[model samples]
Target: MSDSSVSLRPGSTIGILGGGQLGRMLALAGAKLGLKSHIYCPDPQSPAFDVTPFKTVAAYDDEAALRKFAAQVDVVTYEFENVPAATAEILSSLKPLRPGANALAISQDRLAEKGFLASKNIPVAPYRAVHLLEDLKAAVAELGLPAVLKTTRLGYDGKGQRVLRQPGDAEAAFAELKPHPLVLEGFVPFEKEISVVVARGVDGSVRAFDPAENVHRHHILFTSTVPADIAPGIAKHAAMLAKVIVVALDYVGVLGVEFFVLGGERPSLVVNEIAPRVHNSGHWTEAVCLTDQFEQHMRAVAGWPLGDPRRYADVVMQNLIGDEVEVVPGGIDGDTQPHLYGKAEARPGRKMGHINRIVRSE
Candidate 1:
């Protein structure tokens, strides 16, 4: 790791891995801070390239291109968690990869992440690893029916997941999935879902934004509402949990931690997953907070002090998925701010844009 004292000033360049919407937003935020962004992605039509001045269209394993890209940037960060370990290693050897490879490594595998969290005494859903048909059957027996069977790696947006609602469903589900490395999680009968977006500075200081209550449609994030209708104590606990994770990873940059809110006489939170980069759930921070999550991530990766994450107003972020993007330009009111990712084709289940509406102050 580079010395924290060796901060990248405003004119420095940040190299971002993965040229998706998250990268696009980060590039826009960096530009506001007078920091240039160089995007690296295999896709020639990556939307992030539209905003960044410097871009390298190459595969993640292109070491020659990776080295060349690293030499030009002062620091490195990623927009997604699935960044290959080798890619992160090569980049960190040349330029500082803030949040480090460990963060990505842990978050990439479901088993490892759950183990790490459990070791840290952080609550998570009951899970068991599965490798074969017998293992799947045993895991089903232990976790019970109505459990989730998910692949250990590279799964997102409802992919690589199967719900086993009955004992007989396990084998068929496993057959359908053919997941070599899998994890079975006992379902959490939670009333709500929430996420905390937290930033950890190079100095190990952590700052977390308030929890945002999340709503999902077809297993994809539908909306995120800030000033989530939860007890203040429970919100604080969730933020604290995120801070614990950041500190444990020795992370520098922003991370999103998703939680299941169990509503009862005693409100509690259980971690669902850890996103090792700027998250979809945090888009509301763009319109509601003075220092948005994107800028906060840029600041942290550049070795700057952590920014204030407190929101002064209540806001709701609604994603414009697929055809919904077409109506955003005309359907939104004056209070709503529309952000469109410069994606050319709006395929089904693709996130094309989002609109944030400030509802009121806390």
Candidate 2:
């Protein structure tokens, strides 16, 4: 925000505002290019802190800490979309926040993201905003039963959302869900879900990775497979859709654009949602592609030349959830790469690590 014209050179420090797995990976990727990273996070046990010695354990709203962080780093970026708008503003005022505040604003709220995409003539599921019980009832009447009611803000990984199958389910869901504003979306009977990870540079250059088919268990992403059986034309179109959204936002850095495919061999697509940072679905790129999403993101944010995103293998990336962490040690596989996040507690539903298994060199 403060300096879009600024380009960081090697040895520049990039400040990252989240200390999850994504932040940890970003730091590692930056180090490969002679770039240093400073991580700022509230959690003392943040996994990212394990990799980078430069860290500030402070609340995001601590403007004093944020300013001090900005003074040390050349630019700022975040690993997650739920970062507070005020926090983004504080950082942006002092240094350029890659992907900018506009991208964060749209992605943090479901209603805003859907509306922004729809404005560009992109296909999204029919949705309506719900502010009250009566609003939810009216939305159900209009959009019909079997719709999804989700909180407008801070919802991710299947949290803060519910399905209204019966007429009486709406009230229960509304009462259970906190925060007044919500969104009700018509359910699409899609055959498959896919995602394209795209990167936009400060110079207005854009490139996209191949689309990957996604499968979920308990609403958490379980696996992502490259060379999704969708037709070649569909894959091209998915990337084009991602370009439209990224260009419209004037966003810099990496974005994860998800989609829903209907029909069989001849498929029609709908834009599901967009993540303004590196995504779980694109994890396969780390093992298969010469220029993975993590490095691509670093290149974009630091104003370096974007790396080629061509993949060299047919790969399936799988997440190790909770107790599944133990399975990796007893592994037998071909070209399997294990990436474990250094977290001590493997709580249920928590993402402990992931694997990128190369099926064959392509």
Candidate 3:
């Protein structure tokens, strides 16, 4: 059940379950609101450790650590969707877990997420669950060729996925992603990829940032542009879908809903996935909106009234992946707002930070 009456006054502490860049940003946002953030993660070297004064370097399954961590904070939230179910269960039992365990459980697996969306009357790519190699072959036959096989859990940024363009690719694809439950999805001929980021208050009132049009490189998000080049109604409808999912989950905090915009006389939308927390695609909100996604997330999890989700400027947010973080000095511009994650390594495909460039007023 959702914590409909959750209310955390300023100066209360928020327990964050992951200590990646998202946690770092969330911590920064929390500080601005006079709320403290306590980061709990297995890695002592977690980037969020640098941002928040209170941090717990302990594994998710460490019940004693979790109990102590929960006791110190007024409420808990997570930075990532792959937070272990056991972790969420323990945390929620101890403190108010915004966005709740149900959102985490459903969004953690592709099969469950798709099924939940479809059950809510949202359109999704045709998909089938694949358990064995033979199930993979059979699903490819049913969904037709050019389908994608992806792990049901812990897959992100193009990892844990394989494309099967022909019948022969099934065996190899299954082998590559084997040892984990998988789901096969027929490829949607999408003209553009889009996402909507929204925040739902404890009272169930919701507000959404404008949809962002996205482009990808090597399966990772490369850029997201606000005022997505789509029909107004379509953008409005995309926000509606995000609202529908959040309300259904009785979610608090920011949620991201990704979609594929299929082209025709009138373009249509298909639900791709649900992000239970702040998303990469909504990064533009930091520079362009009166209230950024991170702060909005902090507000929701803290049980405060939501800030404006309205975009004041047309912006493009570009991620500085890997060594791209090294070029920050030369990349600075009058209009570009650069945000660097205090990470030590710049390994390939790693999201180090992002820059937002406001193109015009909205």
Candidate no. 3 TM-score: 0.97
Q: Per-residue lDDT for 110-195 in model 3, tens only?
A: 99999899999999999999888899888988889899999999888888888889999988888888556789999899999999
Clashes of each: 0, 0, 0
Score each candidate by Cα lDDT: 0.91, 0.93, 0.91
TM-score of 1: 0.97
TM values, all candidates? 0.97, 0.98, 0.97
Residues 1-362 of candidate 2 have per-residue lDDT tens digits of 66676789899999999999999999999999999999999999999999988999999999999989999999999999999999999899888999899999999999999999999999999999999899989999998989999998888889999999998999899998879798999989899999999999988999999999999999999999999989889999999999999999999999999999988657889998999999999989999899999999999999888999998989999999999998777883657899999989999999999998888645
RMSD of 3: 1.4
RMSD of each: 1.3, 1.2, 1.4
- Candidate 1: minimum summed lDDT over ten consecutive residues — where? 1-10
RMSD of 1: 1.3
Q: After superposition, how far is residue 138 of candidate 1 from its true place, in Å?
A: 1.4
The segments of candidate 2 whose C-alpha lies over 4 angstroms from its true place after superposition are 264-266
